[model samples]
Target: MTPDLIILADTVHTLDDRPHHEPIQAVAVSGGVVAAVGSRSDAQSWRQAGTRVVDLGTATLTPGLVDCHIHPVFGLDLTVGVDLSGAGTLEEVRALLRTEAANDGEWLRGWGLNPNAFGTTPMHRHALDDVSGGKPALVRLFDGHSALANSRALDRAGVHGPEEFDQASEVVCDGDGTPTGLLLEAAAMELVQRHMPQESFAERKARLAGLLRDFARSGLTGGHIMDHSEESTALLQALEADGELPLRLRTAPWCMPGSGEAQWKDMARSIGTGGRRWSIEAIKLFVDGTVDNGTAWLYEPDTLGQSTAAFWPRPEDYTAAVRYFASRGIPTATHAIGDAGVHHVLNALESLAETVPADVLRRTVHRIEHIESVPDQLVERFKDAGVVASMQPTHCTHYSLADHSDNWSTRLGPERADRAWRCRDLRDAGVTLGIGSDWPIAPYEPLPIIADSQLRRRSGHPEQQPIAPAQALTALQALEGYTSHAAKAAGLWDVSGSITVGKRADFTAFEMDPLTTAPDEFAASSVLGTFVDGEIQFMLERLG
Candidate 1:
C-alpha cells in the first residue's frame, strides 16, 4: 500500500541519534508515522493509491522546531514613536517621538528602546513634550525594567517622580527631586499603571492566540511559557479544551514575595495549565532584577564600583519559595542573570538537597535562565547539581558591543561572555542545555537561535568574540536544541522531539538542505511544510 504522505527530498536529516547525515531519497509516511526512510527505489513499494507525494528537489527536511524559552506577548509599540534601537543620536529620538506626538491623543504608549541604546545624547521629557502636541507619551526602556513618561503621564499618575512616589522599584528623578519621567524597576512601572489601565484578560488572551498562530507558522511545536499568570493559564486551558492550541506550551508559574503559603499552593493547583497542549514544568521565581536594569545579582557592584545588583526581599525569600515548592517534589526554574542571583538560587537548591538524597535531587531538575556570567567554580557546581541552563544565545550577540561601558562589559567580562550560552559545556558537564527564545523581549522566531548555534556569529555588532567558538553546534545539533533538548527540558522527551515510529508525528519539513549548507545559507532557509500528528500544518514557499 502507498503511504499517506510520500516526501522525496535531497536530504532528510531524520534527526535521530544517528541521523541521515547524507541525502534521504524519500520518506514514506503512513498513518503519520514515518513508515519508510530510505532511497527512492523502495518508496514506490510503500506508496498507495491515495498517497500524496511531495518532490522537494535538492531541499532538506527535519523534525519540527521547538523554542525552549519564550515570553508570550503580542505586537509591541516599536513603530509607534522614537525608537532608540538604531538611532545615531538623542536628537533623532526626539524627532521621531515628536513626529508621533503630532497625532491627537490623550496619552502615548511606546516600548523597545534602551536608555544607552545610542552612543550619544540621552532622551529628556522636554524633548518628548515638544513633539507631543499636548499629550503625554510613555516610552518604555528597551529592558522592561524601566521607562520614560512625559509630564502629563506623571501628573496623571499623581507623582512628580521618585521622591514623591512610595514604592520598591526605583524611579529616576532629577537632582532636584523632580520626576525626570524615567520610571525604573517594577516599583516605578506600578506608578505608570495608575495612569494607564491595561487590557482585560480576555483582550490579552485573544492577542496571545495570534502569537500562538505565528509560532505554529514558524515550525515551533513547543515552548516554555514564562511570566505566566492566572489569566494566561486559564486561556491556555480554554485553547486546549477547544483544540485550538496548535503548539505545545510548557507553563511556568511565578511566586510572589511575602505571599502566604496558602496563596502559592492554591494558585499552583488552580493554574490548570498542564495536561493538554500545555505543561506545567515547574515554579518559576526571580532571584534578582535583570542585568540591563542593573538589578542582576552580580558578585560585585557593576563596573561603576558600586553594587548596582538588586536581590529579592532577602535570601530567605528564595529559601521559603523554593522549599515550599521543592518539598512537594516539584522542579523549579529561576531567573538568575547575575552571579549573585545564580549563587543565591544555587544555595536554595543546596538547601533543598539537604532534605532530599542525591538521587532525588537529580529528579528535581532545576533551570537557570540567562546565565550571562557564572564564575568558573559555579560552572562545575551546575554540572554536579544536575541543573539545566535554560539560556538565550542572542543576548550575548546584541549586548557584547565593544563601545559598551566598562560596567556592562565587566559584568560578564570577555572571558565569561565568550562562553555565555555554554550549550556544549552544559552537555559535557552532565547538565542539560535547553535553548529558548524569550519572546516579546526576544522575538519568538527560532532562526536567530539556529543561526547563532550553527555559525557562532552574532547577527550584528561583530567586534565581540564568539563564546565557546569550538563549542558551536552543527545544524543538526542546533535543530536538536529546538527539538529533543527542548522536549527533554519540558519532561516530554519520550513523546515528541523525534520523527521515530512511536513519537507523535509533529515534524517540520524545510525546503532546503540545512544540514548540507553552510550556516549563512541555512540562516536564509525557510520552512516548506509542517505536520503535527498526521495532519498538514503550515507551508511556506522557500527561496531558490
Candidate 2:
C-alpha cells in the first residue's frame, strides 16, 4: 500500500488527547485521510510510485485552523467596499468616504468605522453626507451591530421618523423624533439596506469562491458561519457542486422570535449534518445587541444607564425557540454579550435540559456566542449545561483596555469590566472553549488571535495595557481552542480536529511552532501552506 501524499515537517503536532505524545517527523496521507504519522524513516517505507512528497524545512504542522464563528460572504462584501478599519481619525474616514463616493456605484458602502476615532465629535447623517456628496451611503461600525447612513440613504429607505420594532433595534432620532441616520442592530440597519441594490446570484457565487480561497490563504481550513440566507445557501451549493469550495463551512440560519414552531420544524427537517465540505445544523439567535452600540441587554444599565432592552421583545418567545430546537437534537448559537443576555440564554438551555435526554443533548451541543460578561454563578453552569463558549479572542485585544479606560470599560464600570472575557476561568471550570476571529468585527487571521489569547494585549498598540492578563490562556490551550475545541463546537471533531490516523488530511503549516513561540513573535510568522484532504489549498511562493 502506498500513500497519496506525504508531508515532512520539522515538528508535527497531532494534538491527540493522549497524556504524552512524541513529535512526529512525517504524516502520510491516502485517499484524503491521514494514513500514517510516525518517524521520517517509517514514512519513507510506505512511499511508492505516484506518492507525492513535500518537505517543509524548519516548519511546524498542526491541525488545520478553524474559526468557529465568521461571516465569510458578508465580510467579503464589506471588505470589497471602502475599508475604514485603518482610519485613526475622523478626517481619515471622511477622506476615504470622499474617494468612495466619487466612484460610479449607485450606493456608497463602507465597513469597520469605529466611532472612538472621532473623539467627542458627534456622528450624524450630515457628517456622512458631507463626504458622500449627496449619494446614498451606509458605513458599518467595526462591531457590525450599528451603521451610519447618509441623509440621502435615509431618504431612499424612507426612514424619516422613529419606528417601533419587536426587538432591541433602534434608529437614532433627533429631539424632534427625526431619523438621525445611526442604525442600531440588524433590524434597524436592514431598513436602509433594503433599499440597496441586491447582487446577482452569479456575482454572489463568484465572490464567495474568491473569499474561500482568501480564507485558505489566511490559514482558515473551515469556519462556523454565523448566519445563512437564501443567497448564501445558493452560493455554497454552487461552490460544492463545482468542487470550488476550498474550506469546510457550517452555517447557522438565523432564528428570530415569533418564527413559529412550524417554521422551525420545517427547517429542522430540511437541514442535515451536511456533506464533507459544508452543512447547516445549527440555528442562530440573538438575545441582545452589541455592547458598544448601547443595545446589549444588561442587568444594570450602561454608564449612562441606557439601552436596557433585549433583542427579543418577548423574552419568553426566545426561550421557547431554544427549547424547540434543542428538543429536536439541533444545536443553537445565541449571540449574548451582556451579563443579562448571557443569563437568559443559560437559563433557557438549563431548563430545556431537564426534559431532553442525555443522548439527545449529547448529539448536538448548545453554544453561546461571545460570553462577553457573566457572573461567577453562570460561569460555573456552562460546564454542567454542556455549553460551548464560542468566543473571539480578538474582541478583547481590539476593544478592551486593562486599566478600565476603553469605552467598553467605561460602559461597564470597574467591577464588571474586571471580569471581561473570563477565558481562563471558564477553561478551569472544565468548559470546552471554541475560539474564533469573528472576522469583519476584527481581523480574520487565526495566528494573531492565538497570540493575542496568550499576551492579552492589542496586536499593534503595545503602549496600551493588557486587558485581564490573568484571563489569558497558555499557547497550547489557545491552539486547542481553534483546533480540537472548535471542531467539537461544530460537531466535526470525530473527523477533522486532531491529526489522528483515519482523520481527514487537513493541516496548516507555519514557520514556527506556535506552542513554543513568543506571543509577540507571531506577528512576524508567515503561513507556509494550508492543506485540505491531502490537497494543497494554498502555498507561499518564494520571491527569490
Candidate 3:
C-alpha cells in the first residue's frame, strides 16, 4: 500500500528496544499507522506520488508524547477564574483577588491558589473578605482538593456551620462552630460550587476544544484523562463532529466514595465507548486527597493531626470496588498521595491474585497517582503487584522546596518529606514510572515537565534549590516517562508507545534533540510540530 504521509528528521529516537545498526531518520505512515521506519533513503523509495512528506530540518522526532494523567474536563471548571499560580505571598493573592473582584461578574472566582502564599496565616474566608468587594467569591487551592470561599459565598451556599460528609471532607469551622469558609474535598467544595454561575454548553465545548489544541501545541499527541463526565463525553463528540481531535484521548470516568456495584457495572460498560479519537478505557478512583491540603491518608498524622483518614469512609469498600473492576478486566488509576494511601492501594491490588484467576490478574494494570511521599517499603511493591506508578514531577519541582519550608514538606515533616516523589527509586526498582502534568494542579507543558524530572526543580528557575535531588531522572528516562512508560501505564504498549513500524502514526517533533540538549535549554525549546494519526495537528509557521 502507498504511504499517506512521510516525516523526515535529522534524528528519530524510535525508543524501540530491538537493536538496529542503522540510525532511524525517516518514518512512513499509511492509513494512520506506521508503514516504514528506516534510513532517509529507505523512506524516499517507499514514498508514492500522492504521499505528503514533511521534512523537519534539524528537528528531532520521537513517539508521540502522552501526558499519563490530566483533567481537561475537570480543568474547564477548576481553571475558571484568575490564575493565582504565580502569587507568592498573602498580599499578592489578595491583590490578584482584588483585581478580579473589580470585574463585573456576579461571583468572583479564581484557581491555582498556592497554599504557601498564606504562610503562617490560616486559610479563612476573612483573608478574602476584604478583597471580595462584598460579592460571593470562591478560589480553589492549587491542590484541587480544597477551596477558600468568602463569607458571602458561604452564606449564599447556606453553609453556616459544620457539615457531615460520607467521605473525609470538611467544612472547617472554628471554636464556636462558625464555618471558616474553607471547604475540603469535593463534597464540601460542591456546597458553594453549585451556587456559582454555569457556563453554557457551547461555551464549554469551545473552551475544551481550545484547551486540547493548546495541549497538542505543547507537543502532546495524547493524554490519559484522569476524570470524565457526561458533559465531557458530549463535548468531545461535538468537537469531533466539526473535525478530528487534535490529540488522542483515553478517558477514565470517576467512581467516587458513595458509588456501589451498580455504578461500577455502569462504569464498566462505559469502557471502550468513545468516538474516533477519544474513548473511556479505565476507572479513576481516589483513596485519598492532596498532602498540602491536609486530606491525604497518611500512616501517621501530620503536625496538624489531619490526613490520618482515608477518602473512603470505609476502607474495605475501596478494596471491594477494586476487586469488582479487576474481576471484570478493567484497569483502575487511584489518586493515592501519602504512604498510607499508596500502601492501601497496593494491598488492594495484591489481594486480587487471591480472588481473580492468575491469567486475568496478570493482564490487569492498576496505577497509583500522585505518590507524593511513600516509604522505601512501598517503592518495590508497585513492581511486585504489577502496578504502574503514574506520577507528576512538576508537582514536586514547582510546589515543594528542598529546605522543607513549603506546605507539603512542612506538613509531612523531615522523614516523610525526604521521600518526596521517589521517581528514580521506583524506576530503579523495575517499576514502570509514567510522568504527567496533572494540569490545573500543575502546568501541562511536556518539555518543562521532562526537564523538571531531571532538574528536581522548576526547569527555568535554576536559583531554586532541588527538592529530593537524588530522586531526579535521567533525560532519556524522563522522556520515556511520557512516551514508552506512559503507554504501558494505560496498557497500550503494544500499539502506541514507540516510533516503531506498525504502531499508530503519532509523532512529536522538537526543535532540538531532547536527549542531547541541556535541561534548561530543552524546556525553553519549541515543539517543531506534532502529528496525530499521520495528520498534522500543529506545526510552527517557520516549519510550515
Residue 322's lDDT in candidate 3: 95
* lDDT against the true structure, each candidate: 0.66, 0.86, 0.93
**How much does candidate 3 score in TM-score?**
0.99
RMSD of 3: 0.8
lDDT of 3: 0.93
Model 1's alpha-carbon lDDT is 0.66
TM-score top scorer: 3
Ordered by TM-score, highest first, the candidates read 3, 2, 1
Q: What total of clashing residue pairs does each candidate reach? A: 11, 0, 0
Cα RMSDs, all models: 3.7, 1.9, 0.8
- Candidate 2 C-alpha error for residue 54, in Å: 1.6
Q: After superposition, how far is residue 439 of candidate 2 from its true place, in Å?
A: 1.3
Task: Rate residue 105 of model 1 by lDDT.
Answer: 61
Where does model 2 exceed 4 Å of error?
A: 19-22, 273-276
lDDT per residue for candidate 1 within 1-544, as digits (tens), equals 4578877777666656756645467877776566667778767787777888777676666777778777674232222344455543566776667666666566776666655544434445665766667786788765566777888877878877454322236666778888777666666767766666466767666777777878887777667876666566677777667565777677777775556688778756744446556767677777776666566777766653433444556568668878777666677788887777788777778778677666656556678877767766777888666677787766655455433342346555565445455666666677767777676555556766677775566643245556457667767667777877777776666766766655766777675665666666656667776666656656665521
